[model samples]
Target: MVIVGIEPTEQNEVQNHYNLFKLVRAPNLAPNQVAFRIPPNVNKLDIRDYLTHIYQIKVVDVRTMNYAAKRPVRKRDGAMRGKYVSKYKKAIVTLCDNFKYPPIPDKQSLDEYEDRAEITRMNFRRLRGWKPRPQRINMRKKERYEKFNDY
Candidate 1:
């Protein structure tokens, strides 16, 4: 996987849309903040560079954790059902404490954050052509017969 850092504009959009944020393991921020997944085998220095260039933020520190791919489960047919999980790394980027974001004046309470999360969940609710249910073959045939049987 590639170690590309998410852009600041994109990050702001995501934050406005998802009400979630990322943070590093620095001494300033909370320890269990948001985490970003990086591609496997990415170099530490490259990740540092990405954080600075793409996010346009001064990274005070960076750290990563790697996990091994998990094996697939056995199927009833004596064959493996699914492939092994992909291996990836998580990067924790600690930004300079002076970093500041535009305050969300519209969101005055925690409930507002929850509402924003729900909106993010429904981001693609009005997509143009995203049909989840396909037309059944027999149903199509029945409709054709109905349309012509008027004679």
Candidate 2:
């Protein structure tokens, strides 16, 4: 997609990828309700205002949350660590009851997706062979190593 005259630049871009909205599924959310990951500084009211003014959607309610960053934990011993994560904000915006979300693509798009998946499956089968691999013999039961040989 491109605009007639306007060209996007790295610094000139208003916000980073983090500021974009991604559709998500939530068990608790009702129909036509959508979820978006927003900036930590943005509030619920700001979200409502932005949706109404920019997208022209009538926002019924906006719920925002700021999730805490995960603390680092030891992977195996004190020498290694894992699960480094950053804190982020999420907004659940409920559109007006009258609004309807777009319908899922018909048979054509779904057929395309199925074709792509089939191609990927065929590629894997070609490289690995179509037959199922033989089960691995249990090495732990009959231990072969007399000592802890790192090699």
Candidate 3:
């Protein structure tokens, strides 16, 4: 004889998959983005599919990191005990070209957004090999302190 636990339908299974939602990381990646942390077993391909099919983001690139465990102090009853924290993985996905986040006027405002965008464009030009604008030399210097006199 065999026993099987109650099996939920496909839709029910998918609803259960909502567990992954809770695992996603905070979405505070810069002004125009967000991020998520998934299981280490998830590869770049899987991540791309999830972003495309689930979140619907046009991913420009994906960066990953493998964490390693570290030893901890040993402690016990009137003694010390040793332990280690488990390792995990992380990823950072950059959005593709032409993707733009909707206006966050409440946070950035219009003027602030334009200033930031201009600075960003300048930075990008620099990265693309643009030379820095020439700087003007300051022609002022403080005078040296005079000798102190005591009465």
Q: What is the C-alpha lDDT of each candidate?
A: 0.55, 0.59, 0.50
Q: Write the per-residue lDDT of candidate 2 for residues 80-114, one digit (tens) a residue.
A: 46576777788888888643444545775464564
TM-score for each of the candidates: 0.43, 0.49, 0.40
Residue pairs in collision within model 2: none
Error of 3 at 48 (Å): 0.9
Give the distance in Å from residue 2's predicted Cα in candidate 2 to where it truly belongs: 15
lDDT of 1: 0.55
By TM-score, the candidates rank as 2, 1, 3
Put down candidate 3 lDDT per residue, 114-150, tens digits, no spaces: 4466567668878999874523111111111122222
Best by TM-score: 2
**lDDT of model 1 at position 150:** 75
Better of 1 and 2 by lDDT: 2
Order the candidate numbers by lDDT, best to worst.
2, 1, 3
